[model samples]
Target: MSHADAGPDDDHPHEECGVIGVWNVADAAALTALGLHALQHRGQEATGIVTFDGARFHSHRGLGLVGDNFSDARVIARLPGTRAIGHNRYATTGETILRNVQPLFADFEFGGLAVGHNGNLTNAQALRRALVRRGCLFQSTTDSEVFIHLIAISLYSSITDRLIDALKQVSGAYSLVALSDQALYGVRDPLGVRPLILGRIGGGPGGWVLASETCALEIVGAEFVRDIEPGEIVVINDAGVHSIKPFSRQNSRFCVFEYIYFARPDSVMDGMAVYEARKRIGAELARESRVPADVIVPVPDSGVPAAMGYALESGIEFELGIIRNHYIGRTFIEPTDQIRNLGVKLKHSANRGVLAGKRVVLVDDSIVRGTTSRKIVEMVRAAGAAEVHMRISSPPTTHSCFYGIDTPERDQLLAAHHDLAQMTELIGADSLAFISLDGLYRALGKPGRDPASPAYCDACFTGSYPIALSDHDAAPERQLSLLASAP
Candidate 1:
C-alpha cells in the first residue's frame, strides 16, 4: 500500500507541534534553531522562526527538517533579532503548506506579534466564523491563526490584555510562546494539557527562554527555572520574568502519553523524568503481566527503555531482537509492490541470532492501529522465534485525543473496536496485554487515578475528555454553517 493510504497513525500517535521563544539572548534566532533541532522529533514537516530586531519582525519558514532549512548561516543571518520565537510543525489542523507554517506573524493595531502554539483549539472553527463575519480576513487555515485574529479584534489595548481576552473566548488545550516588541510571552491552557517551561539563559540577570520541553532549554545552554503553571502567563523582558494568572486555577491534566511515547526519552515534563517514568511503567507492566519468556525484546528505540525495565523487573534477559534503520526517512519511496511489501524492513530488521528458537516478549510503547505490530511480529516469527508475546507500556488507547496529539478517528482505533482476545489474534501474537490505568498512576507516583480528578489527562484511555470538543460535537446544522462559511 502507498504510504498515504497507510495514514498518519500507522502504529504510533504523532506529536502536534513544538514551540520555543528566546529573549535578550545573543544570536537568539540561531539559538531558537538549535532548540528546534532538539525538538525535531516533535514535528518534522515544517520549521519557522520570527525575530524582533527592535525595529521590524524578521521571519523565515521552510517546508522540511530544521537541518534542511536552517543549516545555512545566511538563513540565520537573514533573521537577525535579539528576541525570537520558532516552531516545528507536524500539522494537526491546516494542510502542510508554507503559509500554514508558524510562528505565524501579524501586524495589529498596536505592533507586530508572532505566536507558536503546541495544542489544538477545539473552538477554532466556531471562533473563525464569528471573526470572518466581523470582517477579519484569515491569512492561514491553522487554528493558531485564530489567536492572531482574536488579538487584532480585541477592544483591550495592551498585547497581554488582548491575549488574555482572546484566551477567554477559547476552550481547549494549548501551550503558547508569543513574541512581541515589548516582551516574550508564554502561556499554558487552564488545564495545562500541553507543556511549557521557563528557563534562564545565563547566570545572574541573564536572558530568558521558553519552550515546549526542558530538553530545548538544555540545548540553548539555558537552565530550566520552572514549569509554567496551568493558567499562568509569563512575560519575559529586560526587567525580569513576571507571572500573570489570567484564568482561575484548575486541576492540571497534562497529557499522560507524553511519558509513554510522545516526548523524547531524555526530556523531563511536569518535573518527572520521562525515561525514569517509562522504566517505572515497564516495571509495573512486568508485575501485572508476567509470562513464560526466554528473552525480552523491545520494538526498538521507543520500546528500549521500557523493555530494559521489564527485563530488570521480570528477571528476563533483554535482547535487541529488532534493529531499526535510523537512516530511513518518512518519505522513503516505494515504486513497486515488492519493495512496498518490505515496508517494515525498510525501517526495522529482525536480528535472527537474537530471535532464533527463543520465546520472546516484545515490549512496545503503544499500539494505535496494530499494523506495524503485526508486521514486526510476523518478521520475528519468520526469523525463527518460537513464540512472540506483546506487552504495551500504556493502556489501550480506545479514545482519540483532541488536545494536540495526532490520532485516528474513534472508528480507526484498534482498541476502541476490538476485545483483548481479538486484538491478540489480529496482531498475530501469542498473547497481548497493556498496563492498567492504576498501574500507570502508580508508575507516575500516584496511588491510583482519582475518578473525581485524575492527576493527568488520560482521556485517550478512559474516554473521559477533559475539554469540550466544540468543533467535533457541534450540531449538524452548526457544523454545516461552519463549512458553508469557510473562505
Candidate 2:
C-alpha cells in the first residue's frame, strides 16, 4: 500500500524522489524497472521510465507503484532500447498528475533529452517566472520542469555544455540522471546534499548504472564502483565514461537523515553502510539516555534495527511488542467511524503478551508531528505497559526540509514548538529522550559536529540551512531575483 494509506499514525518525513539510469545494457528499460523497485522505499506515489533505442525514445509513466506500472512484459517490450532513465516520484513540488510523473522528456535543437531528478531546486519558482516573462510556455508545475526550459534556451553548442549551463543557474540539492542520444549523464549538486552512486553491470568495460543508492546496484547484479562526487558529472557513451567537474569543490553536506531514516537499511551511501550507521546511532542513543525497562520495543519497520542496537547496549531484553501487517492495502474499507478510528490497528497492533505488565522502551527513528507517536504510545499503555519510555535515534527534527524531503512546516513540527517534558506529556509517555546531535555525529565516526563546518547537513535539527532558500524567502514579497550561481 502507499504512504497515504499506511494509517493515520504514519508520520515520518518523506523522500521526494529516486532516480536510476542504465547505459549499454540490453532490455535496459526492464533493468531500470528492477532498480526502481529496489528504490521504491524512497518514493511510492508514482514511477516512470524513459528509454532511447537507436531510432527513437519511448516512455511510460503511471500514478502508482513501480510494479503496478512496469511489471507487465508488454510494457517492457514496448520500450526497446539499450539505454534508459527512470524516476520514482512522491510529489513534494508538484501535483501527482500524469504529467508530473517524471523522466520528463523534451525535444531540443541538439536532440531529445529525458531527465530524472532526485532533489528539489530552491530557486525554481523565480526561474520559472523569468522563463515565462521571456515567452517560454510551461507544461508542468514541477520545479524540475525549469531544467528543461533552461536547457532549451541555453547558448551552448553541445548537449553536455548546455546541461552544464543550465545547472549553473539553479540553486538546490540534486542527483540528476539525464539520457540523450549521445550518452547517459549523471550529475550531483555542488554541495552534494543528496546521494548518487555509480555501478558497473558486469566486469571490465561493461554496461554502467547510475542510481540513488547502492541497493539498486545490488538488485541489478551490478558491481559497486564509487559514489558520484559532489559537483561532478559523468557521461557514459560507447567509447567510455568521461567525468567533468563544472563547479568549484566544496565540503559535502549530505543529508544526515538518510542514515537515520530515509534510506533502506540494506543500502549504502557515501562509503557508510546504512544499516550499520543506524545501529550505531541506536547504541549512541542508549548510551546517552539509559532508562531501566523490562523490554525494548521498536515502533516496527524503520525502528527495528535501532531497537536491536538499543537492547544490546542497554542490556535490556528485546521483543516483538509491536507487530506490523504488510498486506494492508489502500482500499481497506472503513465502513463506520469506529473502523476509521481503528486505522492504526490495520497496519500496527500491540502484542499484549510481550508488552503487558512490562516497562517498555519504544525506540523510533524520529518524532515528526507527534500524532503517530501519541497513538503508538496509547496503544502500548492500553496493552498494559507498566511504563512507556520513548527514545528517538535522531535529534528532534525542528525545521522543515527544502532539499527533496517532505516535512511539515516549522510550526507543525512537534519539537519546533514544545520542550522535552511537554512533548513527553503530550505523547502520553512517562519520559522521552532523543540522541544528542554530538552523539549522532560520534556514531557516524566523527569526534563531534564542528559548528564552524559541520560534517553533515543537520539543518532539520539546527535550522542552519546549508543552501539558501531562495524561492521560500522570495515568496513573501518577491524581493530577490533568481540566483544564477550554485550555493
Candidate 3:
C-alpha cells in the first residue's frame, strides 16, 4: 500500500507496484495483461510480462501504463506460453529507467528463471555491496536483481530450494511471482507485510492465478481460493497447487494502510472489504471529531467512500464541493515557470456554487505532507468556504515506512514536526482531526492496537519499524552512495 518517491510537488503516498501470474493456461500473456489492467491503480509507470511455452521463454516489457504498453494484440501474442508472470511498476528501489522494468529474466544452469517482485528489500544495499565484493557484476540497480544473483550463487538442490535460500538472506517485505519451465511460484514475506492471493481459473480443468489483490482475480474470471499465507511458497502447474513453508513463521503484520487507501474498494484483504473498512474508519472519525459545518465534502476519489460513511453516521449531507479531473498523468511539467503550484489545480477544481458561504468538512484518507491539504484548503477558501475543517481517515503519518512504501525521512514528515494545533494553523483549516490509532484498529474489526505487539504494520504512524533497517538506518555516506548507484 505504498508508492515510489513522488516529487515534493506531488506530495502524496504512492503504491510501489502490482504483480500477477498464471500457470497452465492458454493465452497466458493476454490473461496476464487483463489482470494487470485490473491492478493498474497500484502503479502506472511501467509494465512487463514473461511467459514460457514449456521450452523457450518470451517477454515484452516497456515503460508506461499497462494498457499503453500491452493493449495491442500483437504485443500479447509475442509472449506465447502456458505459464507467465507480470508486473505494473513504479520503481521503488531502482531508478525510473527501461532496464529496471521487471519480470527480470535470467538464464540459469538449471533452466530459465523470470521474476516479478513487489515491495522493497530492506537489506538490499547491504546485500548488494556484499554480492559486489564477491565478484558479481550487477545488471540493474533493482533489489529484485539480488534474487537472481543470490540464486545463481546458491548451492541448493532444487530451484525452489535456491529461491528459499536467496529469500533467507534478504529482509523486508515482498510478494513475488516467478516463472520456470516446470512451474510458476508465488511467495510472501514471513510477517505477510505485503499482499498475495491464490485463485483458480475454473473449477478444476483450468489453471491457477496469483496476484497482489483479489480484484485482479475477478477481472480474469478467476475465483478466490484463499490468501497465500505469510512465510508461504506455493507452486502452481499442471499437477495443481502445492504449498510449502520455507521460512520460519512470524507474527502477521499486514500493512494497515491498504485498508485505508491503497487497495481498491471492491478488493478484499485479510477477509475484509477495503471499502467497508474505510467507511468504518470514517464513522469512527465522525464520532471522535464532531464539528459544526453546513456540509461534508470529500477530497474526491479516495475520500469519497469515507465521506459517505461520515455522512451516514453523522447525519450530515455530503456534497461534491471539489471535482477531480479523472485523466491527469502521474507527473506533470509546468508550462510556465511563473505559475507556482499549478499542479494541484490541474487535477482538482473547487465548485464555487456549492462551496460558497458554506462551512465545510473536507474528508481525505491521510496527510503525508501538509502541502496537499494546504493547497486544497486554499482552493476551497478561494471558492468562498466560510469555514474549512479537515478530517483524515487515518492517523497522522509521522514516521517513514521501511518495508516498501517510499516515504520522506521522519524529519520531513509534517506530523513528525507539527502537533495537531500547529498542523491546523499550517494547513489553514479551522479545525483538523485524524482517526485515532485505536479508532483505525477498531474499524478493521480488531481491538485497539497493542503497543507491546501490534497485529498490523503501523510503522509510518507509530515510528516502530517491525523489521530491522539494516541499510537505510546505516551511515549517511552509504545511503548517498546507494542513491548515486541507482541513477
Candidate 4:
C-alpha cells in the first residue's frame, strides 16, 4: 500500500520531488529504491532510477508509485552499478508522463550525467527560450532539463565548473543531486528554500550518500552527517567527499511548509524533528485561538499529532472523531458529480457517537482551496457536532508557491480571495483561525521570525518571495538573455 493516503478531493498544495544518490554501494540501485520509498510522501506520480556501471549507464523510469515501478527484482537487476541516483516526481514543474520521470539522464561530451532535482527553477522558461535560440534541442518539458542544456553549452574545463556555471545562471529553490561517471555532486541553492542532506554509510571508498530528507538516509542505513549548506556543493567519489562553495552565501530560507506538511514525520530537518515541530505548531495554535470545545478532533492522518498537541495544551480531550479510510487511492472512476462530492465520505467518515452534542475543534495543517475542509466540516456538522471550530496550524496561504510546491494561482487560492470571516463561511465552520506568521517560526524553536534574519520561507503567507518569477513575470515579446549572471 502507498504510505501517502489520497482521495479525489485532495485539494491541497502538491509536493514536488524527492531525490536520492548513493556512491560505491553493491546494491546502489536497490538502496536508491528503498530511499525513494521512505521519501514517498514528497511525491507519488512517477519514479525513476539511473545507475552507472563500470562500462555504461542504465536507466529505468515509469509513471507510478515507487512500489509499482521498482517492485520487481528484474527492474533493479537491470540497473547494475556501483553508483546510482533516483527521483520520485509529483509533476510540479512538468506534465506527468514517462518522459518527465527523473533522474533525467543525458550524454555529454565528457560522459553520462543524471540529475535528480527536488525544487523548481524560477527562470526555466527564459532559459529554455535562450537555449533554443542557441540551437539546443530539448528532450523533456521539465525546467530541470535546462540545467543539462546550460552545462552542455558551457566552455568550462571540468564537470563541476560547468555545473556551477549552469547553477549560477538560474534562480529559485533547489536541492539537486547530480551523478556523472566519475563523481556524484550534491548542491543546494543559495536561498536553501528546499532541503538536501549528506550521509555516510558503514564502509569506506565511497560510502557517502545524498537525499532529500533524513528518513531516506535511515532507510538506506546511512548515518546522517550534515545538511548540505546553502550555496554549497559536495562532490563525492572514490577519493572522498569535497565541499565547494561556488555561490555567494545568503540567509537560509528553508521552506516552512516542509515541517507542516511536505516532510515525513520521522525525518529531521536541520537539527529539529519534523513531528516535534508540528506538535509545537499545534500548541502555538491552541494559545493563539482558544475555543470552548469538549473534544479536539483532528482531520485524520496528518492532523493527528497536532490535535494531540492542541488537546494537551488546551486541556481538552483528543479523540478520533473522524475515521480515515487509508485504503482509498488517488484515482477513482467518478460517474457523476454526486459521486465526486461523496469523496469526503469515501476517504473519511465522521464518528457520530463521538461528535454528537459536543463542541469539537477541528485541527488541520492548512486549508488550500477549502474544498476538502468544507466537505469535512459539513460531514462533521451532519454527524451532530453542536459547534465545529476550525484551527489551522500554519498561516493563511495567501500566495501561490513558485518554488517547487504546486499551489493554485492567487485568484484561485481561497485565502487570497476572501477574508477570515468569508473563509469561515465558505468552509462551513462555526469559527476559523489560522496560526500567525510569527507563531510558525516559534514552533521551529525560534523566538519568532526575526525581520533581520528570517529563517524559513513563508512566501505562501507573506508573498515576499525571495526568488524572482522569471517566466510568470515575463512579457510575451521580452527576449531576456539569461547567458549573463542571475536573471
Model 2 lowest lDDT segment of ten: 478-487
lDDT score of residue 331 within candidate 2? 57
Each candidate's TM vs. the true structure?
0.95, 0.96, 0.95, 0.95
Per-residue C-alpha lDDT of model 4 across residues 315-343, encoded as one tens digit per residue:
99999999988777756625678878788
Error of 1 at 287 (Å): 0.3
Per-residue lDDT of candidate 1, residues 198-304 (tens digit): 88896547599999998898888999889999989998888799899988778999999999988888889999999999999999999999999999999878888
On residues 1-487, what C-alpha lDDT tens digit does candidate 3 reach at each position? Answer: 1222234455667778899999877888999999999988777778999999877999999998888988899988888987899999876677878889998999999999999999989899899999999999889988989999999999996999999999999999889999999889999999999999998885458589999999999989999989999989998867788899977778899999888888888999988999888889999999999898889999878898899889888999999999987665545534554443676787789999889999999999989878888999999999999999999999999877777777776667899778999999999999999999999998888899988889899988886778887887687974664344231
Q: Which stretches of candidate 2 lie over 4 Å from their true place?
A: 1-8, 333-338, 477-487
Q: Candidate 1: list runs displaced more than 4 Å.
A: 1-10, 334-338, 477-487
lDDT of 3: 0.87
Clashing pairs in 1: none
Candidate 2 lDDT over residue span 64-122, tens digit each: 89999999999999999989999999887878899889999999998899999999999
Name the regions of candidate 4 deviating beyond 4 angstroms.
1-8, 333-335, 476-487
TM-score of 3: 0.95
Backbone N/Cα/C clashes per model: 0, 0, 5, 0
Compute the lDDT of residue 349 as modeled in candidate 2.
92
